[model samples]
Target: MPFFDHVGPEPDDYDTSPKQDVRLTQLGSASTKTSFTCGDAFGWANRTPGVPDLDSRVALDTSTDLASIPPFLWGLIASYGRHTMPAILHDVRCDASKAAAGNGGRARTAYLRRHADHQFRHTLKAHADQGVVTRYIMWCAVRLFGFRPLGVAVLAGIIVSMLHQSSNVFVSVSDLLNKVTIWPWLSWLDWVPQGIAWGLAQLATALRPNQPYTGIMIAVATISLVALVYRSFERPAAGGPVRFSLPALLSLVGAGVVGVLTAPPVLPLVVVTMVTRFVLWLLDFVMHWLDLAWTKVLRLIDGATPSNVTVPEGAMLPAAVPPFPGFFPTP
Candidate 1:
């Protein structure tokens, strides 16, 4: 039997169609939503063995972020995209499980959390137009952070480690800032953040059992590459976030998984990619600023009307201020 039994033909995979109107609205910055009732009932029952089933419908008032995807990850899998419908169904079912577990004690809560996460995975498989690799990765992320205090802490540490390692990118940004004559203090302070990040990584390592900094670093690199690979397959945006053709998305995601599992030496490659992007970004920033400054100089010269020309009667004159703003001073 199929894993999920829906009430009717499954809802559209995405809301990009003119005819499809998504009913959920974001509630502030958090990935959550205001409660709203559904016009038609959407139901799902698990037929897969060993997996818990909700055995209920989802027509009632629902509040969800559509997906629990973090903001930083929106570029890869947006909170609302092809998987929007499945996420909604999963959210509703997870809520039901949470309510049931409230009175069932800690063990029951843990059990239900697993059930909820598994159901989420199954729903994604059944409804989302996503590859198995993508769906499984998302499910694993959910499962990892579903364990409450410990899981949340670990995830948070991993994020900190990733940011810490990526701090080297900003060293070039600092140098460029110094050269642009913006803020000298910011230029030498790049090491401050790097130092702080190192300290935090140490703290996180101390808290973990095995102090897995190397593993965390490798994981971060792998995830970064996977995101890039998936992003490479993204289709141009029509009205919503960019999406992937099923075939290309599936292929990229599968390749990403295989690469991560088979090739453990990806840290250096990701490091190179990161450094190259940073340097390119710095160059672009410098060029844009130089272009803007040159344009401003030309505008001033153009507006000056040669000193040899007589001013028109009652014509407005230039303000008594520095001609180049921050780069110069008026006497």
Candidate 2:
């Protein structure tokens, strides 16, 4: 039997169904206002060829509803979340294989994998060749000090050199003052003792695991001491007779006083000064060595001849060089 034959002609008249009754309820009325939809929120109708329209529906088609907004709206949302939204979104959409292919990815990946495997094998062989104990020691050194242990060693040398130079200067000055009869009590003389003490304390602090303040003080003091030293030792060039420039001297003194006053403590101040001097000296040495090495290396690599490297024939040497004697073979 057909299902339709079992039912009545009229749906409302069917005996198996409830009686049809029509009723209407009036809803609270709201004032309607016409407004244009934001144009940016819709897809772009016109765009330059080869240029993706940010307003296009395709650009808005993101996996997440949050991301499926118009590009400008998405940018606003993303900016509010921090500019990381673009990167996060890119990551979400990223197919590593596709990305790699864009930049010769296959070749790069193969190269990296090959290099990594070779490195692993080399490391294993190195360990085996060195024996387990030797390898362990090497590993510990690398882990503790890193690949450039020479940097720390260089710093240590600089510190030592600075200490030596300062000590010599202080001793020499003190001896010179003792020999002189007049003007014995100079405030400037106190700088040496204060500076030395400060340097030692700073060094101690830097070596100490728990004391960070020592290092801080050392840095502050060192700066002041260098200024003081420069003012004390600065001299004019040969043609310009040596004379103390009051302005320079006043500036140095002012800076030193301010540094000492604002410094954390006396000990740190001295240490900092000493360390700074050492650093400066080290830097000067490094620069000098680099200059020499660079010149030598360039000459060697560029295949420059010694004759060509000589001072130009017409160029006069500095007056500092001693004059050579004239030929005197007489009959």
Candidate 3:
């Protein structure tokens, strides 16, 4: 393969080459129905030019399971397909980077992680089968959150909002206690800590003072904007669960200032996006559960043991059963 400066793999990358050895077998885990094990070696040689100068060889063997799609995004994307090669490649690279970091290459981990994201974005752009919007969203998600789990990303967004709410409550209670000369017992508790309370209180009072949802709006907007810049050009964080870097920190502060000034009008839009996400997640969960149940039902109707219905190599479990009962053609 020749190296190219352009984004994405070579155009011939879309073809299924026999040399890739890309067979997969679905595991029989009820809890992880979406998981699949590679039946043979799957490999990608990074020929995309201008990416980080990390190792170009990546591979997945029989022991490695393909990454499962996050439940929240399932409605927007399928868990498995030829179009998902970019994601699969990304997963292997991230795992390899984690392993490298685990073996005391801590200083270089952040750089490796960034390269993985870059590689994923470019490769995703090359897949003509996936829509432009879908690729963009996936790229943005990888860039924003890196290899962090969906729960961590969600919590990151919510924690700031919670801090804002807690700060307001703390200041309000302190004020209320100050006026209560009638209760000397309550006054004793007021000696807690005013500095921390007042600092948080400033967030609530500084902008959109009367609005309770201001924190959520600012938090979401600040994170979204800062993450865009952070992954795009900001210095990568030191490796660990917690991510922090001077450039990212500065970006966050700047985005926060902008968010506080501009997020009020977009508060309703933020609320709607959050609600819509929850609804989509719920629907995805229900649909997945139903798919698994229906698979079992079909096995029972066909007189085959559900336990024995293993997914063969290079195959996916069917997404659904026949919709109508008559499709079975009862004798």
Query: Which 10 successive residues of model 3 have the least lDDT summed?
Result: 322-331
Q: Go through the candidates in order and give each one's C-alpha lDDT.
A: 0.47, 0.32, 0.47
Candidate 2: worst-modelled 10 consecutive residues by lDDT: 33-42
Question: Looking at candidate 2, what is the lDDT of residue 49?
Answer: 18
Model 2 misplaced regions, further than 4 Å: 1-267, 306-308, 313-331
Off by over 4 Å in 1: 1-22, 25-39, 46-56, 156-331
Q: How many residue pairs clash in each candidate?
A: 0, 10, 0
Question: Candidate 3, TM-score vs. the true structure?
Answer: 0.44
| Candidate 3 Cα deviation (angstroms), residue 295 | 21
lDDT score for candidate 2 against the true structure: 0.32
lDDT string for model 3 (74-183, tens) is 45455566544555567767776677665435434545666676666566565424565555545544544452432234434544555454555544644443343213
